[model samples]
Target: MSEMQDYRSSLSDPKSRKFETFSYLPEMTQDNIYKQVKYIVSRGWNPAIEHTEPEQAFNHYWYMWKLPMFGEADVDKILAEADACHKAHPNHHIRLVAYDNYKQSQGAAMVIYRGPIKV
Candidate 1:
């Protein structure tokens, strides 16, 4: 199995979920999404192409219907959508993550935070 699948399989236990990490490129540009899809497909994940709005791209394998973050975008809208969707698809829990691609100039190359939410 590829590295991504191996890593994801290792995370099979939800309670064991640790700090999620990934190398996301400059937002969800078409190119970046394509690359993400490639990684998914290579991992033997057949993602659903029947995408609806808000959840621009989705994969049942990851239990996530991602709403891509464009350049200089606010994640509040996406987070709200995920919250609503989370209620509808309780079995497939959703989480929101942001990618600040070119924000390296902000001197905030990487960030980590902790908080409690009723997931």
Candidate 2:
């Protein structure tokens, strides 16, 4: 628990290269999102995360995230999280683009941000 908190606290550090961003796409889903998440993960950076519009998030017509890509080693965990998003919201078809914190894939990384938020 403390370790996670430490990592979160470290993000606010100005010197830290953990910059975060988002893309509001309305027609996005797991199918299209896989690539983007894969790409970010491949870059060895974990994008930030945000769940804004809690009510409409992954339900109506919106999706939000914070891309805080720190490094390339966190791809595996991130990819799993992305995969979980699809399973969690299979009906809503919400895609999860993220900066992974673990890596366990091929040297060929993937990048394509398209999910339930946009086309």
Candidate 3:
């Protein structure tokens, strides 16, 4: 059997930025994002969108795109809201979040857009 790679050796650059759980992986395609949204919907979690400047992503509060989409089942509507938020704040980072009412906490969260890297 081949040896497993060391996780420590694959550490990301400290200066480089990361957002939420999906950032460690390769950039997600539209289909991949849709799948994730569908999964959240399947789990009966409420979907919400938030945006903030990349610089403030770590410590600042994100402005919600609108109210949490409680009982929303349409994945397309979720994506459309995300798209509208991006159009409104093209320079801000956008993220999709799922609130678990049963658990009284967040069920899932992922960055859907990374703002242009400021030099």
Candidate 4:
């Protein structure tokens, strides 16, 4: 377990070339995704969806399918978009991100996993 932790820590280092700009905040699941996104929207954060193939899961430079900006009223739309991205990339890792415009940083994130880590 410590070895894996060390590996993850090394990957996160900026000089490692494997630095991740994103990460999962909670357990991966559809229900959790909706709940987290709803809470973020309630806080006035904008939602966005992104994904990447399992092989590139740790690459950090995942592809953004939808840019953040979906407002509270568009919660369902964003949720559906997240679902679609998961379906399209069933063999990949999908995530939902909420950006707090005022904070200028990611407000929250949730991942929908496809399988266990190779390690």
Candidate 5:
């Protein structure tokens, strides 16, 4: 039974990378991304967007798209901002962050767009 189990090796390429938790899963669709943003807004968490070049992603602090959306209840607006950021920096990795005010910390984060991997 052990032999029948499937096993997969981890990526060994130095350039091959993973960012936030969502990166490990399959690419999300527009509906899926909308759902995620909705979840964050439902929790009353502030949504923010950030971006960074593929190479700088692991080292430097990501560049904030704009100020965090405090008291933002409209999920569509949040998604629009994220989309705008992605459109502005199509070659950079785009991330969505949720700030939890009560906890004074990040409640959730995910890389929504992956920049092209430079070979």
Candidate 6:
């Protein structure tokens, strides 16, 4: 198979409107969400949960609610909070962002799980 393309660069919108990467999921479940969070934590990166409102769909910035600086031990708590956020904002866009504390830059993985697009 041919190599996958990095479409982020081809986006016509401003860089602010683009997601961290194309590694986003159309839907997110508890099992998969936990697994992704666990994997991110295992890599020694800090996990932060962010969400955007319908009015802010094009907003480049997301509001961070739950940020667990702990390691794998905090997986359950982080996942629990994520679940809560999803439940509360069933129609909003939610995502898990992993940041490298040492590098102070966002990791390549930006897992997004959101409800069906309106319109």
> Clashing residue pairs in candidate 3, if any?
none
Q: lDDT values of the candidates?
A: 0.34, 0.41, 0.89, 0.65, 0.86, 0.65
Comparing candidate 1 with candidate 2, which one achieves the higher TM-score? Answer: 1
Q: State residue 94's C-alpha deviation in candidate 3, in Å.
A: 0.3
Clashes of 2: 32
Q: Using lDDT as the measure, name the better of candidate 1 and candidate 5.
A: 5
For model 2 the TM-score comes to 0.31
What would the TM-scores of all predictions be?
0.32, 0.31, 0.87, 0.67, 0.86, 0.66
| Candidate 2 lDDT by residue in tens digits, 34-112 | 5565675556654543333222433334444334335644555665654555455443423333433456333332222
* lDDT (Cα, tens digit) per residue for candidate 6, span 75-106: 88777777788888887767777788889887
**Count of backbone clashes, every candidate in sequence:** 0, 32, 0, 0, 0, 0
- Which candidate leads in TM-score? 3
Identify the superior model by lDDT, candidate 2 or candidate 3: 3
In candidate 4, which residue pairs get closer than 3 Å at backbone N, Cα or C atoms, i.e. clash? Answer: none
- Candidate structures ordered by TM-score, highest first: 3, 5, 4, 6, 1, 2
- Give per-residue lDDT, candidate 1, residue 74: 28
lDDT tens readout by residue for model 4, 45-85: 88887888756766668899856555654667877887788
lDDT at 85, model 2? 52
lDDT of 5 at 44: 93
User: Which ten-residue region of model 5 has the weakest summed lDDT?
Assistant: 5-14
lDDT of 5 at 32: 96
Superposed by TM-score, candidate 2 places the C-alpha of residue 89 at a distance from the truth, in angstroms, of 11
